[model samples]
Target: MSVRTATESDLEAWVALRLLLWPDTSPDTHRAEAAAVLAAPEATAFLEKAEDGSMRAFAEAALRHDHVNGCETSPVAFLEGIFVRAEDRGRGHGARLLAAVRDWARGRGCAELASDAHLSNVGSRAFHAALGFDETEHVVFFRMPL
Candidate 1:
């Protein structure tokens, strides 16, 4: 399998893969946001492909100026999300995708990579642990109407 950074030309395919993996987003929204993100100098997307040229996994990361736990720099490299097609999950595509993101962050001088998963997502928690991430503080979130 090969791993590479995503480009604007890959927007449609990336959005489709993201929807297939997550299933909670509208394709239109995914495309719009992905285009904007791909245009950002401090954000990046990566794709893992099988030798047959099928996309097996993808990951995105961005620089955050705010303080993030476990990060020692202002521009913390935050992993937005990553997914490997269920059929490809056990074959290391996810790990390759993550490695691409980490390499991108390191190239940009990021201090650390950070990620968050839903509190009830056991699979996500286990994956993070397997990747050597420690459990940090958890908090209840609230939003106020203007």
Candidate 2:
């Protein structure tokens, strides 16, 4: 029932949730990425812990100075990821975490906050909508080896 900044001690639980959200990434890669993210001054991660001292949910966000999809401002606050265990859904944890991140973004002088979900993830889209984010555009990305 408390929200706090994520720490290295929470890495295992954090990466477990990350794996659920992004199954394609290898555990080692996720560990490295999470470490880099946590070390960045422009990025922040938040964790919600239950009464028993275990993590309930987590959220990661960053200030994107580069062009961000659906953003009209430079240095927009972007929600990189969020997840609440299935058992914890519908308890307002998501909303509370998002509000804290939104405030963090504002404190950094960002004018807007942005996030996106996979096109086929209807539930995530609905969740974002319920949290007040608008559906701006649809895009499919592609990459080719050099």
Candidate 3:
């Protein structure tokens, strides 16, 4: 499996995989968001393709100049999303995609990479830990509508 940076041509496939990861969001929204990320200089996405050229996994990241929850520096790389097809898990595709993201961040002068998973997502937590991420803190958000 070869991992590479995603380009405009990969939009449709990227949105498809994004839906699998965030099914609650609409496809139109995913398309718009994917397009924006593709056009943003501070953000990037990496994709892994199979021998047949089908997309097997994808990861999106961005350089966050603001404070990142657990990081101690400005301009940290934030992993916005990563998804591997259920059948493709455990094949190291995710790791390879992350490696690419790491390189991209380092190229942009980012010192650290930060990411978050939902509190109840045990598998996601384990995935982060397995990849050498240390748990920093847990946070709960509150919202009030006017």
Candidate 4:
């Protein structure tokens, strides 16, 4: 598999992978958000493709100027999302994508990388841990309708 920066030509495949990662979001919203990310200077995405040129996975990340949990730096490289197709798991594509993200972050002068997963996602937690991420904190958010 090969990993490369996502471009306008990769938008459709990128949105498809994003929908698989975030199923609750609508396709139109995914398209709009993907476009915005593509256009944003502080954000980027990478695509992993098979030998046949089929897209197998995608990862999105951004530079967060605001405080990111567990990070002491101002401009943290925040991993927004990453997804490898079910059949494509365990082949190191995800890791390769992350390696690319880390390089990009380092190039941007980011001192730290941060990511979050839903509290109930055991698999995601394991993935993060296996990738050398330390458990910084767990937070439960509450809100009220005013």
Model 3 lDDT tens row, 108-140: 998899999999999999998988789999999
* 1 against 3, candidate with superior TM-score: 3
TM-score, model 1 to reference: 0.92
The CA lDDT at 92 in model 1 is: 78
lDDT of 4 by residue, 27-90 (tens): 9999999999999999999999888888999999999998898899889999999999999999
After superposition, the stretches of candidate 3 with alpha carbons farther than 4 Å from their true spots are: none
Given candidate 3, what's the lDDT at residue 105? 90
TM-score of the candidate numbered 2? 0.94
| Reference-based lDDT, residue 39, model 1 | 89
Clashes of each: 0, 0, 0, 0
Per-prediction CA RMSD (Å): 1.5, 1.3, 0.7, 0.7
lDDT tens per residue, model 1, 1-146: 78899988777778888898678989998998889788898998998877787777889899999888766777888989888888888787878888888888899888688999999999998998898778777868899999
Taking all chains together, each candidate's TM-score versus the true structure is 0.92, 0.94, 0.97, 0.98
Q: Which model, 2 or 4, shows the larger TM-score?
A: 4
| Predicted candidate 2 versus true structure: per-residue lDDT over 1-146, tens digit per residue | 97888899999988888888889999998898889889999999998988888788989999999999888999999999999988999999999899889989999999999999999999999999999999999998899999
Look at candidate 4 and tell me the lDDT of residue 23.
94
Better of 1 and 3 by lDDT: 3
